[model samples]
Target: MMVSYVLVMVIIIKGYGKRIGEYIDEECRREIEKKWERWEEKKRREEEEGVREEMELWREESRRRIGEMKERMEEGIRRRIREKIREKKEEIEKIEGRLELEEEEIGEIELEEEGIEEKLRI
Candidate 1:
């Protein structure tokens, strides 16, 4: 009789232990799934933020390069304009000098013509 009672108790204990083990396994699986979901969500958010930061950095770099290019272009234009102005001034001076020489030649020719006309009249 004692042996029978012990055997029945052992069976009941093993059945209860199996049930508890299954329940614990299910609870642990649910917890792991929840943790995995949270981790995935966190990773996704981090990736999104990292992408945004990269885009912002690219935009900033692009803007900086563009600004530098614009400044360089403006400087080049200014230098070209200055060179043109200098060239124009040099050309005007050359023209003025030629006109002065032409005027002097015309005055000498007029004097020679007047002398020849006076000799003919004599």
Candidate 2:
């Protein structure tokens, strides 16, 4: 009977030990999962910050390029306008010269007509 009691007590002790071990393992798993979640959150935040920084840099670069393009375009337009004005001034000068020549020819024809009339009246 003592031997039987000893065997039963040993079995009960082993069972209790297994239960304790299972509980410890469960607690360790929970802790590991919590640590993994924290690490993931940290990595995600870092990635988001990096992306935002990159986007800001790109935006600044784009703005700078656009400003340069606008300046170049304005310069080109100004040059074209200057060239057109020069051409128009030259055209006006040519027309004025032709008009002067025409007025001189008409004056000579009128003087000849008056001379012819005076000779006919005599």
Leading candidate by lDDT:
1
Name the lDDT of candidate 2: 0.95
lDDT of each: 0.97, 0.95
Please, what is the TM-score per model? Answer: 0.81, 0.73
Model 2 lDDT, residue 110, Cα: 82
lDDT of 2 by residue, 14-120 (tens): 98989988999999999999999999999999999999999999999999999999999999999999999999999999999998888888888888888889888
Model 1, runs deviating above 4 Å: 1-9
Q: Which stretches of candidate 2 lie over 4 Å from their true place?
A: 1-13, 110-122
**Candidate 1 lDDT, 5-120, residue by residue in tens:** 99999999898989988999999999999999999999999999999999999999999999999999999999999999999999999999999999998998889899999999
In Å, residue 116's CA in model 1 sits off its true spot by 2.2
